[model samples]
Target: MEMVQMLRENATLLKLGYQFELPGPRMAATGILTRNQDQQRQKRMQERKAEEVVEQKSATSSNQEVPTRKIAEMVKHQEVCNKAQIRKPKTKKLKNGANEKESEDILKDLRNNLKPSVKSRHEASNLPPPQRSGRDDLMAAIRGSSIFSLKRVNLT
Candidate 1:
């Protein structure tokens, strides 16, 4: 009976040892997985570096130096000089015009005609009184529309 029990125990120990044995192919599979993970990490780093380069280029392009005040003043002076040169012919044409007195009279008449009309004190005193409300004004406008609404036909 003791020998049989010892034999059974030895069989159980052997089975446990077999179950714990590492498979040869599994080690190679794990090595492939680690290499793939390393490749993925390297790819991500390269993409990040490329993005940084693009960002740096754009930042540099946007940061141009502004022109100084002296340069702006020089440009303005050149423009004024150019405009003065262009207007010299117009000044000569004005000097060559005929009948200056007649032109002056016409200009005076035009100025007088374009002046705004002013109400005299007596005329303002004779004006009609203001209406009491918006409704009264609207009614007045409606009553005054008959002349505008009249229709006329050509006889010829």
Candidate 2:
């Protein structure tokens, strides 16, 4: 009775039709509350802090900046030099137009020959005859016997 009274005292009354939430282990557990605006603001502040850190690092090493800049320029210049030095051999244009046409025609003929011919639906449905078993032979013999014959003969 005391525990029930304590629970009733700690319970929160909801606005919707006398619904109450009793304070227990489950009720005490807090869930994550998501606020998009707050999260976005925090993300922006983190990015700004990162940018400031990069700026401060660059500002601190003035002597190192010159060598780094020179190295980047040298890398770009070397890439350009390498691209200019290595020339791809230009493809020679075929002079014989007749030979090109002949080769294309030969390829078309070979491709057509390599392709399999499709069978018609009627031919595809043609199945092999079913193999007879001992049970089938027994059934046929019983049907042919005179004792179990289903035929009726009329006599005048």
Top-TM-score structure, candidate number? 1
lDDT of each: 0.65, 0.63
Model 2 per-residue lDDT tens digits across residues 1-156: 343344344424211122236555323222111233345668899999999999989888875657677898999999998887787566545556557777778889999888765665557668777899999999998788887575678998
**TM-scores vs. true structure, each candidate:** 0.29, 0.25
lDDT of 1 by residue, 25-135 (tens): 444444444555666778899999999999999888776555578789999999999999988875323445757787788899999888765666568879898757989
Looking at candidate 2, the ten consecutive residues that score lowest on lDDT are 25-34
Per-candidate alpha-carbon RMSD to the true structure: 24.7, 13.5
Cα distance off (Å), candidate 1, residue 61: 0.5
